[model samples]
Target chain A: MPYPKVDVDEWRLSVKGCVEEPLHLTYNDLLRLPQITQSVTLECAGNKRALRDPKTRGEQFLLGAISNAVWTGVPLQTILYLAGIRPEAQEIVFQGMDVGFRTDIPDLLSYSRSLPVTKAIHPDTLLALFMNYEPLPAKHGFPVRLVVPGWYAMGSVKWLRRILVIEHPFDGPYQSRDYVLYTRPDDYAHGVPITEIQVNSSIAYPTDQQTVRRGNQYVYGIAWSGSNNVTEIDISTDGGHIWQPADWIDSEQRYTWRRWSFHWKADLPGEYMIMSRASDESGAVQRQQALWNVKGYVNNSIHQVKVYVE
Target chain B: MPYPKVDVDEWRLSVKGCVEEPLHLTYNDLLRLPQITQSVTLECAGNKRALRDPKTRGEQFLLGAISNAVWTGVPLQTILYLAGIRPEAQEIVFQGMDVGFRTDIPDLLSYSRSLPVTKAIHPDTLLALFMNYEPLPAKHGFPVRLVVPGWYAMGSVKWLRRILVIEHPFDGPYQSRDYVLYTRPDDYAHGVPITEIQVNSSIAYPTDQQTVRRGNQYVYGIAWSGSNNVTEIDISTDGGHIWQPADWIDSEQRYTWRRWSFHWKADLPGEYMIMSRASDESGAVQRQQALWNVKGYVNNSIHQVKVYVE
Candidate 1:
């Protein structure tokens, strides 16, 4: 579905439910507040779907969908504080302006998700109004959007409309079911909510299966971790037989990926499986085998590419 | 030398000599005139200099010096028409605001170049004031710059201050001495001014000498011709013995390079030499051996990369 054609003058963001004093604000009201700008990278949860299986169930997006932009907005915590959250509030539900009927659910519903009150009031969580120093484009959420730093892009709800403070945990379909990771391949009996990003890396150059001449060559890619800074990236040329560290191209930035490069001298010819794995400061390393789920959520498995040396 | 910081308010571009009336225009005056915009690639004359022999004279620039941007300004033809060129005019000389002493000439000279009157009034030639939709950055020629599309960056002089019409051909050191191509390796006696770009292609991915794993791979790069649209890009994976056509990624854009990609299946693990050559619609093909020049101005020889698959 396309983004809702919202009338900025008529759009009123309501902060009700468990709030001590309910409040509704126009688009201009949000801009009047002190705004801070930050550069952040938002990666879709299923960014490497095509690599997992040639016929994945979801859109087979490559790494290009990810982008870093300067976002300017007011911190969600600032507004929550002004609304005077009730002591009983346990979660905050953010509803997007976009609405449609789900095949699985009979009733028409607006796309929404709920976050624990603690996560909602985090300083990094923002109600973003600008992107790349300009008013956000409609495709990227025009009037306002929610930005959850260090988390999967789904957490940063777009076309944000309502923020409801709930006294108990809110179990919306998107929050409790859709974005869940099924650790076992076959069954969906046990699952966990997908939150922070897994340690991940992808080769940006010498695109997948690139043919190269035999010689000393450089391999480079970008790596990132959701909740923690990427500590190191390792490249494997002999199907994990030997590993070497790739040099970091830039200093690590919080909530942003870092570029790395590795030099490899190919003395022999033939086919080689080149793979890159990333580890975060939190001791989280990309897994060789991703935990399969029907929805293909956080599949941060090691990224591999094949190349021919002629 | 750093960019000469010229006050925009004090700067006035003068069009004089061999004209019915001399014209003096401020920055605002240029913007007020009918404007045209185009996206053109500006490549330095010495781009890819490091690829040449180390003994080659002139600054060795790598690949980063080339950039493409949307330039908005009045066409040089429009301004020249307004000044009313005389039939006696043979050349149009452009002088930059920067002043420096040339050790060879032993005189303070504002860097300048002259184009034949016929070339000066070409519709694509622009007196650009804006780059990428924003006012040109100071380092990129702040108030105004001359943009000669499809020519080497030196032809697009920056920090432009004056345009002089001449009845005789220009013989400036830069035009006749520096940016000349020496056909013979050992002698500079037979030289010609470097004009339009040579048919060229460069590997943007799997950079120089990168190693990859054994498997299917895609080789892609950008190709462009100086005076005509790129027609075909051929890839040689077997040391230039076997050549294959790469698929064009997008429709051709005038004055812009086209991206092309090829699929290669790496079945053996070994070393290989990969090379790409471009051909233009004008029947100009990239040469296997570049013309040996003292300045290394147009080194559009076939680009080769050595990679090891293991």
Candidate 2:
């Protein structure tokens, strides 16, 4: 089901959690705060799962989220600060206008979640008023949405309307219910909580992706992760066993993808199996085989591409 | 030196790779092909290169490329089939009219790339004539471009005007001189090759990311990869040490993002780090840190998001 839609004027996010005085801000009201500028990434936690082939297939890269935009808004903590936190206030609840459809086990779903207070006051946390140098898109979240940087997209509440302080986690279908994980292979039981996106890579050229070889050429693509930042990415002209590292350009932001290039002489014509792999500081990297789960979560399989190198 | 802003009548891409006769396709002629439709992703080879922070304290998750659009145009191979291929034809090359600016290099950066004939003929690759149900935007390739599925945006040369075929890889600056991995920290002597983007994930919510308090709320985002299709994405309310899974809703296209949900109770309130990791059937998973290299290429590092548990 789609999130609840509202007229621009009817939209307002209420701040009642752990505060001295409750605060309510309308779409226009959010514009009044001392605007702060921040560049943040909001991503869909679930990425690549099924669909695979060294050649002739859909995109091998993960999906959803991973968008970066400039945000302008007021500090979330400032609002929380004004709403004097009660000593017992342990968490701040966030709710969105999106109401989900009815499910088999539950009556319906309303999108909402919560976080601890300390983070609410972080200097970077803001109620975003702008995106990509423009007002937010309705599809993205118009009016106001909670901005939580350096965190997964989940922290950002869209079509935001209500906020409250509570002593414990809110047991909603989405929170206490969804976003859990089953640790074991056969463990269909969802127990883990949902949050971070993992590091991985894909093959974009001579990509088993299967493209027409019209002439001599070049190839290009992107890579990224959340932990220590991208340090190295390599491509293999002769498949996974042998590989060569690629070049990178330095940048101011570390949460961005590092581009790479591989030279395919393509002089001696033959069928080639191209592949690429990425690794991070945590010593974690892509593998040849994929892990299995009932829901198919965290599929970080290596990428293999094929091309007729003329 | 942009591709000398050619008039639409003058803009055309020549199809010459391994074909019996070289076929030149004008803007109008290219648009005349059976208007095929497919949702494709255009990922900049170097998008989000600035941000990939897990250990460092910089904003990560800048989105570049990896864009989805419903494309319309002639299938690349359709034109190739008309031209007829030479059995010895080893590769297909694509040349573009877009030379937006001059790099430190001498020649204008007229985009160029190639695909083997087999992959180029795949049903999905299109000599794109339209985008998002509309004509091409000037900022984008106005006249025409190649739509190579499951590949980086670079290979889908924009403002395309030429298709060459050579026994060797297209030896243009972009072919090997450019877009190739030229350096690495540990192995400065040798560089990696460019091939594909690794399986990766990014934060799409909390777009203007910052810290947030934990409580009853819903966290949602997207994920994908170029190698394996996203199977499942895991979320971490804490930093990446532990992870939980989320739910995904099917959207229209394959390369497009599928909405996923994660509900957080936020019982623990403190400085909470939120992140997500994705995995694909090929076994490529996300990690907190990415491989460190000289010119960071394909930085598929784990996504780190900082939030506070109240």
Candidate 3:
């Protein structure tokens, strides 16, 4: 979908519902508050959707949908504290200005997703004003947007306009009808909502199907896990037959990707498949194949690239 | 491999061997000569190497290895005419300064390739000095490079230094061994050298595994062929089970890619494997699968992208 053009001056972020003090804040009003900057990696839940077998329904995203950026914004908890959340509030719903009609639904709906009150009040969640040191681009979310670190990017709602403190469990389309993993169409009641990202790694150099002369070469890539830091990365040069530890190129950090590299002596001439596997501090290792879901979400499979040596 | 640094002032292009008048021209001398610009598409011979079944030997390039640009250069025929080729000259050999030692060979070898004298003297063959209105970048080839239009990019030798008119066939590694298609280990002698590009097409948008909501959408991509213009492009939304002609978005042109689009009314929700098949003026159509070879060269198969409609 195209980005919605929002007039920054006319835009007002409304915080209502079960809040003790309903508030409408202009862009400048939020900017005047104490701010913090953080480097965070955001990945689409549907990344690597193309690799899913039997094919699932949804936007088929490849590995390129994940990225890291430094964001400057007010803590979401700061706003919630100012508005004073009611004791009965059960969830916080974030709604974006972008809306569309669904083929299966009769009414037009805005893109919205709700988070548990605990997560919404976390200090890490932010009402982001700047990304990579610049005011948010319209495509990302201009004026203001929600940044839910460690979780999939869908929870970081863009073009945000309203925040409602609800007294009951929220069941919006994005929260209940989609983003939830359903094994069978009739199993909607048992569907699980996607949350934390799984441990994952991808090969960036010696791209798939590249031909190289036999000799010394460096194989490198990036790895990330939700909430936890990547502790190790293993490289397999012989089609996963054997694996060797890769050296970390960057220091361990929270909510950001870690770079790793392995020096490979491609001494023989022939075809080989190189794969990277990552493990998080939580002892979570990337799987060979991700469990299949109807929406093809949370694919954290080991990444592989095929190369030929002559 | 990193680009070879050629000091323009110290560099001299030598035309020798079977030439009637051996000549050495400086960078400034070549710059003083008349030049012409032409838009041409250059595709690596190993493009789509990953798509080859049973796997092939070489760099596994995807569909991105092909590109079009306006190249500025002096006609190679003009320089060959100045040097005056001998009547006994059977082939013209072009050599680049980049050299490296191979594990199988004891001596360091420079990259080189040869073309028949007829193709060498063709008016379209060029000694390119600029690409897309800018001087050749070091990564591309600094100072000068050979641009063989209508042929696989392997023929366009980069970091050019020597031009030799030979009385016999050239048996350089690039010319007779690497770029040749070998069906079996013992088929080296009968391996065919890759030449003109085959008719081909690729979907640029609505990438593989992309999910889209049911509605009106445009499926667009590019198509190209060697020498001949693309005559038609057919899009199949049902995994090649059906084919519909696509409308041309760009005027038909020789030696460059043509853009085509199809307006699709996606009324239903399901899985789709969108495919594009292109036919050229020569009546050549993209095949379902390209003929397999050890080097994986000249693959011009129809392109397919899987998408989900929600």
Q: Give the candidate number with the greatest DockQ.
A: 3
lDDT of 3: 0.88
Which digits, one per residue and each the tens of the lDDT, describe model 3 over residues A1-310?
Answer: 7889988889999999998899999999999999999999999998877556666666756568899999999999999999999999999999999999765576999999999999999999999999999999988899899999999998999999999999998988889877888867556778888888889999998887677778888998999999998899999998788999999998998999998889999988887899999999999999888877777888888899888777
The better candidate by DockQ, 1 or 3, is 3
Report the candidate with higher TM-score, 1 versus 2.
1
Q: Better model by DockQ, 2 or 3? A: 3
For candidate 2, write residues A27-94 as lDDT tens digits: 77767767888766555544553233221111223444357678888898877777788898888888
| Cα lDDT tens digits for candidate 3, B213-281 | 788889989999998988999999998989999999988878899999998888788878899999999
lDDT of 1 by residue, A145-169 (tens): 9988888898888898899999887
Candidate 1, which segments miss by more than 4 Å at Cα? Answer: A1-310, B185-189
TM-score of chain A of each: 0.94, 0.82, 0.97
TM-score ranking from best candidate downward = 3, 1, 2
Docking class of 1: incorrect
How high is the DockQ of candidate 1? 0.02
TM-score for each prediction? 0.51, 0.50, 0.85
